[model samples]
Target: MIVAQAKPIEEILEMIDKYDKILLVGCKGCVAVCAAGGEKEVQFLASAIRTARKTQGREIEIREVTLERQCDPEYVEQIRGFAGDYQAILSIACGVGVQFMAEHYREIPALPGLNTSFMGGALEQGVWSERCQGCGNCVLHLTGGICPITRCSKSLLNGPCGGSSNGKCEVDPEVDCGWQLIIERLKALGEFESRFMEIVPIKDWSTSRDGGPRKIVREDMRQ
Candidate 1:
């Protein structure tokens, strides 16, 4: 899922300091699962903002709302009726949601309340680690279910560069060599010879962000 972290309260306050009334919009999607932006988080932020403003003898109004998703047009449209009621919208969704809201409501200021981190999964309790880069290709089969592109420091197609030592990456001793994990797993499965011996061709980045923007459409769905 897309991981994100909340921006500092001071930064958020600065974004909407000029506005007397603001809308704190949260997303119950990826950000919610990550505990960054959700219904509970929205309430917390609204209270914090109000307290901060009250200390300065300035009265401010903040209305909190959580949407099922901010990226989808259907869910985004749900806020259309009352969006203009606020001076600015503080979106606690991912960067994509903030941009989507900005475009959808061109006249209203869409302020980001979180820093979009990366595409990753929870490693353990309260710990999240980066796992995928979404390179628009899948090579897990050949690498014993390990991704060289995302795991390897250099993203080497065929690697464990000369810098690898003791099964550790040269970039960081704490980091395990991506190829070492792949080789060990493949060796245990007795497929090292078959898989490791096969040469992997250079990846075609055109399928990724090399092209300006990508879209997928299904004619069957349209029908």
Candidate 2:
């Protein structure tokens, strides 16, 4: 899932300080699962903003709403009816969601409340680590299911760099060497001799960001 972290309250306050009334939008999507932007978080932020403004001798009104997803146009349209009532919109969703809101409501300012972190999964409760770079290439078959592109500090394709030592990356002793993990995994699967011996070709990056923003269309899903 896409992981994100909330921006500092001070920065958020500065973004909306000029507006007396604003729409606080939350997404019940990836951000919600990560506890950064969700229904409960929206309420908490609203209260905090109000309290902060009150102490400054200023009054502000905020309307809180949580959308099933801010990335989908269908869900974004749901707010069109009353979005005009606000001076601006504050979205606590991922960067994509903020952009979608901004595109949909061109009349009002759409501001981001969270910093889009990366695409990753929860390692444990309250701990999430990045696992993929969405390189548009899958090399797990050649690496025993361990991703060399993301797990490796250097994004090495063939093998570990000279900096690896004691199964750990020299870049950070706490981080395990990506290739080391792959070698161990292949050995466990009894395919180390077969898989590890085969060399991976130079990666084709055209499928990734090298070509700029990407999009996909399925003829089967089109109207």
Name the top TM-score candidate: 2
- Counted clashes in each candidate structure: 0, 0
**Candidate 2 residue spans exceeding 4 A from truth:** none
- Model 2 steric clash total: 0
Q: For each candidate, give its TM-score against the true structure.
A: 0.93, 0.97
Error of 1 at 203 (Å): 0.9
Model 1 C-alpha lDDT per residue in residues 48-114, reported as the tens digit of each score: 9999999989999898999999999999899999999999989999998999899899999999999
Per residue, candidate 2 scores C-alpha lDDT tens digits across 1-223 of 9999999999999999899999999999999999999999999999999999999999999999999999999999999999999999999999999999999999999999999999999999999989889988788887889899999998988788999899999999989999999999999999899987678788899888897999989999999
What's model 2's TM-score?
0.97
- In Å, residue 12's CA in model 1 sits off its true spot by 1.5
Prediction 2 global C-alpha lDDT: 0.94
Error of 2 at 41 (Å): 0.9
RMSD of each: 1.6, 1.0
